[model samples]
Target: MPASPREEDVLTARELYRFYRAGEEETLALRGVSLRVRRGETVAVVGPSGSGKSTLLGCLAGLDEPSGGEVRVDGVRISHRPETERARLRALHIGVLLQTRNLLPHLSVRDNVRLPQRAAGRKPVTSARELLAQVGLGERMDALPRQLSGGELARAGLAVSLANSPAVLLADEPTGELDGETERMVLAMLRDRAAQGCAVLIVTHSAEVVRSADRVIALEDGRTTAATAPAGGAVPAEVSDATG
Candidate 1:
């Protein structure tokens, strides 16, 4: 895929490679990943555990730097930027939903969502109330994180992720551990974001997420094994290795 300028693409990765090194040993987590996610599209990265799903997300989110290749989010080259700079861009243009560290237990839903916007260093931050309502948590905005049920907490986390009207959204197993109702709500919110022109990328095993995606990229053993693009999908490539 061509890594064009940001006029059309919200996210782009060109020939990405990531490797971990130890004494006399090395592991390649990603090998030559190249793709593009345009505005208003949801792309799902699906594979078994340890197939470099999290690593891919980290690289895309600028939480980790790739050993080779480039990544751009909303026109910013973040693949190898300093952590501080990356965090700055992430605050302004990215919304992240992960299984861990998504919410602060001591904070109310409203406050939790506000925190990131406060640090985002941007004016006209997203409205907490509007965001909460969009996720069907308007009535629970003032409730503390620990005071909510599992489903409510999930919705709350999503509201927090969208606190800044991010241009690109990154999620890791966003529907995991949620009840049926909560899962549907989350999925709908994700699709809605895409419709609103926010590029959404998720690493997931959930059937619902796969179904919701405009495209699906499957990885195995740290390399892309197969990919189903949105337009004129191609046959899945070959597979390799034992586990992810």
Candidate 2:
């Protein structure tokens, strides 16, 4: 099937700041970070361990509230919405693949992929099968998480994330645990998602992942300071000061 037309701005964060307080100390995780992502585009967020990459993704996915500024997803102000409303919006519009696999140990691969649909109260799309096929796991639909290799489990996680046909896909270290070949396969799947009109945002420390992105944004000490456009669509260099 042909992909939808690219939307101008599928996700945006303006003057975003996040802070956490521990007794007498207050720590700032994200400092005045602002970004925009268009539909059918892949953007990579690279930073060190404390640079706030995950915090930014959390805010963008409406999984956490920002201390200040705003996050808009599909033109809806996610930062201002009530928790229940924001969660509903996320269920309807966003898919996230964290660094850790979140599949249920007791569920088969196919059932795990279908979990998101059940949560969202939405019907599953036939594309779920195609997604599994794309990830090279078409034959493992009946396997349990423990029955699959690390790579196969990752592929299943990817397929599950797509169950909602989400407008925005936020992935954190989607290939962190894979071998070189498996990483390539996972990156290919992510690129295809962007090509299919989903705004793809990935947080990673991998040079390969950075290179695959359409644009690369670097974070330093919780601040965004550098961005590089793709060079003839080639993978770019590792540009962030953050390690993970």
Clashes of each: 0, 5
Kindly report which residue stretches of model 2 are placed more than 4 angstroms away from their true locations once superposed: 1-7, 127-130, 232-244
lDDT by residue (tens digit), candidate 1, 1-244: 5545557799999889999999989999999888788899999888877889899999998889999999898878887878899988888889999865799988889999989888887663558888899888899888988898888888888888899999999998887787666788889988988999999998887766676688888988878766686344432332221111
Candidate 1: regions farther than 4 A off: 2-6, 229-244
lDDT of 2 by residue, 145-204 (tens): 999988888888888878788889999888777888888888898888899999999999
State how far residue 148 of model 1 sits from its true place (Å): 1.1
Best by lDDT: 1
In candidate 2, position 219 carries an lDDT of 85
